[model samples]
Target: FGLTRDIYETDYYRRGGRSFLPIRWMAPESLRDGRFDTLSDVWSFGVLLWEIATLAEQPYQGYGNEEVVHYVRYGNITLERPPNCPEILHKLMRACWTFSPGDRISFRSIVDELVPYENEDFRLNAYYHTQPHSQQETVLTDSNSDEKDLLLVDDNASEQQ
Candidate 1:
């Protein structure tokens, strides 16, 4: 139901008298004041889900690193839901991307939301948007997480049959 590995411990990047950051995957707080916690990890988790739903497509595909930050900060923009993703999963991703870390869903709540799909009835693999939409598998995960994220899902989440 879960997995964990040691993250190569490092602070925000610094070298050559230049600063580097994984701005694309970083949460607002991390970008703003260098704060980090599991909630920030939640933000990264949302990005991972986007990557999966889009079949490994880049997050914020056309935005430059700086543009990604500008949109998130000034415009309150987040990655749009993938056309092939289910509403519930998109909702979960949105929750993870909430601007306030405290408002973001906890890893435990994510499990509660996703557990309903672990049934043998639903297939567990997701396909590209170009493919037929009916045959989706729902069980999911992201790295750097305390929880094992599994399966993308549909509205059948609470409406499980």
Candidate 2:
């Protein structure tokens, strides 16, 4: 049997409700209502990114599930950028956590963003290149203009997907 089947057959699965799951992984809308879809998965992906970036640190470490749910629903609290997380990756995670489902970035865009990091050699060189003050300044200056264009492009691409 597949992993899903094995997990589903467990006693924990037989016990209904989300008591066993972490509230940090749940999207705000999913908590408020029963609605779940790709957008919800996107939110979960953002939480997963946080976990990976923090070396699997439990999210909202000191908060209870109810407290987290309230904070997420009313205060819009999201995972803070981990100490060593790449700015681009953190940006992608933020995009995934957009409050409105329609505004959240698509998984395809997430894959696109991660494609460059997949090549270890390129990543090393790129990391070094990006570290220069001049390069950082250039990126900051260009990002605002690029963001407008990217939003339009991402909207079109997400619609097609």
Candidate 3:
């Protein structure tokens, strides 16, 4: 979401100083023109997922806000998959971070992709620790695997080309 400053009793304007804003979470369009909507939130969610995969490491480490904006807008420096992150989850994060707002995956699609792993015993920590390397490799290699299918949905059905 773009920063807002209260302008009237119940009205707000999307303009503010950038001192506290974390530019790493901002979408390129938002950075360029202060335009934002749900797609911007999707981009931030991708960064949050990256943070989770990296055990909460700071994103765009050592980069200032202006530098991050320039890199993202012009250089297209998206967050890379953290070490040991599951391929399926990293794919979902990439979907969320598509450069075009209309091309980003929907929140509904994200939940659908995650639903298969929602059982009580399906803790991410436990799964990461207990799953054998061979099994992980098999899942990654199988094109028809559930995880791959989960990442392959057509989420742009409503957007015109």
Q: Which stretches of candidate 3 lie over 4 Å from their true place?
A: 1-19, 120-161
Better by TM-score, candidate 2 or 1: 1
Per-candidate TM vs. native? 0.62, 0.61, 0.61
Q: What lDDT tens digits, residue by residue, belong to model 1 across residues 1-161?
A: 23454242132233346766667778888877678899999999999998899997777777766677777655377898898799999999999999988889999999899988765544445334244645545655666677766647663556566
Residue 26 error for model 3, in Å?
0.8
Clash pairs for candidate 2: none
lDDT digits (tens) for residues 1-161 of candidate 3: 43475332121113364344556788888888778888889999999999999998777776655667788776468887899999999999999989888888989889899888777666555666576654332222447686554333334433435
- Please list the residue runs of candidate 1 whose C-alpha ends up more than 4 Å from where it truly belongs after superposition: 1-19, 121-161
For model 2, how does the per-residue alpha-carbon lDDT over 42-100 read when each residue is reduced to its tens digit?
99999899989999887777766667878876646888899989999899989998988
- The CA lDDT of each predicted structure is 0.76, 0.73, 0.74
Single out the weakest 10-residue window by summed lDDT for candidate 1. Answer: 6-15
lDDT of 2: 0.73
CA lDDT, candidate 3, residue 121: 67
Q: What is the Cα root-mean-square deviation between model 3 and the actual structure?
A: 15.7
